[model samples]
Target: MNNIVPIPLSIGNTPIRKCDFLSEYFKTNIFVKDEFHNPGMSSKDRPAYFMIQDAIQRNRIQAGGTFVEASSGNTGLGIALIARQLGYKVKIFVSKSCSQEKIDKLEEAGASIELCDNSNGLQDFQSTQFRAQSFAAKEQNAYFTNQYYNTQNIRAHYRTTGPEIWEQTDGQITHFLCGIGTGGTISGVGRFLKEQAKAIRIWGVEPRGSILQHYLKHRTAPNAVRPFDAIEGIGRNFVPGSFDPQPIDQIFQVEKDVSIDMAQWYYQHTDIRCGFSSAAVLASLKCYSAAMRFHSDDNVLLFFPDHGSRYLSKLYAENSKVSTSNAHSLNG
Candidate 1:
């Protein structure tokens, strides 16, 4: 008799689903890299898994070591899932702005959660990151999986995500769209696609309040902190070290209400629930369709980084004040 063991979780390829609704609406071919199919239920699994494995190879993390990180939500969940399985103690310092559902999910995954005030905005390094850094510094055998600044974050996408998209699209993708948080997904994937096809246009999506759009347009960082926007996982008040703005051909800024509305619209039409950032990308595509002059033959690829279940308390709340029709009108 042959003995078999179960395959480990978090080791598989996620599928790319065609966005038929969006394709018909926009009159262009569109597809979604459905990253929610990942074991951690988000795209962060790719980088988190690779970063941890790289650290182990470098002897920076070993058995019984502690893993610490600062995350809004998804990255922390990814790290916790991998670290706990690998015999490491996981601690996540997260901003209070993160949904309670995410905090509860992290705790359910056996990670200790420390909530930090995000009211001061991203420029104030004393927010969540400083606290996480301080905790990692005190631990004798701790590894900080600093997703924002870690070069491995970019490398992981470059190695895995970029190739997956290229192969899935058969090198026919003309426009690559994604929301930028740590910027690894856009920078790495953009570099790969641009290398393969010079004419491929890479567009980075951000919430209206984020400084990235301004920074890209004016080539200067904002001096004042923008108003708090409810959308998470994409916009940043400060530029992260992993972010390489050079590969991005253009940046699109979407309003918070529009993101929320589009998220709801996607669920209603396609039954594929996505987070705010995913909707932001869709909304941006709709808003820019006229100017970009997308053709029916153009193959547009959008990255949906996480599932909507993680955002039940915020974007998917039952008592959301904004209506879908109003949001569509704003975008239209």
Candidate 2:
């Protein structure tokens, strides 16, 4: 009998497609890393797979073991899908602020859900992370994939995502941009790109309420951080241990309304359905283009972390309250 391969094993090698519309509109070459093509439908699949595999290899977890984590949405979905495929039980402690679509997806993936009240703040122990940690501590044969602090998160992207981008762009990528979450994507990809070509500029995008902008500017975490904005999968009240700001050349702060409107516009115009965080990067790209004149030869790459399907209740909802005037002012 042949050994069965889990579906989650087929996670990486997502496609990088050139954005003809964006390129012509911006008057420069622009490419998008379509992470939505991943089996888990998000870039979170990369790190989640790596972390789980590493845990298994190190005997930290075994078959039929329990996997636990705290996430806003995408990461939990990735882990849940992978765990289900590998016959592991998954318990996700997610923020109550996460979209209904995401919660539904997680439940459909056969993962037990624990909704954490994030109205106060996400960084506190009373938040999702605390609940996840406490659950893992009490459960037998349970492994907590602490994505934020896990070095494996960065290593996953460095070994896979970074190399894939380097090869896909034929080592000619000039600028790489993405929204910062656990900082794994930017840090890992940035390190690899810079190692290959020192001139490659790595830009980190953050929401207005995120502490990353303040941290990047002041070289320290802020004293009093605000609640995480409506945008999910990116931004944090506190910097994660996995985050490495050293390779980032600059950080751009985008507003929640701007991200939502930009995402909707991108979907309408280019037919590329990206989530709010990805749109934040797009908005930042526009801001960056306005400030800096790009040569025709310059190649800019942006990572679209997840698809817009998971944002139906927020970014794509019919009753969603997005400011058209503000979006036009930014894009116009």
Best by TM-score: 2
lDDT of each: 0.82, 0.83
The candidate that wins on lDDT is 2
Candidate 2 lDDT at 74 equals: 84
State candidate 2's TM-score: 0.92
Alpha-carbon shift of residue 289 in model 1 (angstroms): 2.2
Scored against the true structure, residue 306 in model 2 reaches a CA lDDT of 89
Q: What value of lDDT does candidate 2 attain over all alpha carbons?
A: 0.83
Please give the clash total of every predicted structure, in order. 0, 0
The residue ranges of model 2 lying beyond 4 angstroms of the native Cα positions read 1-8, 119-123, 319-331
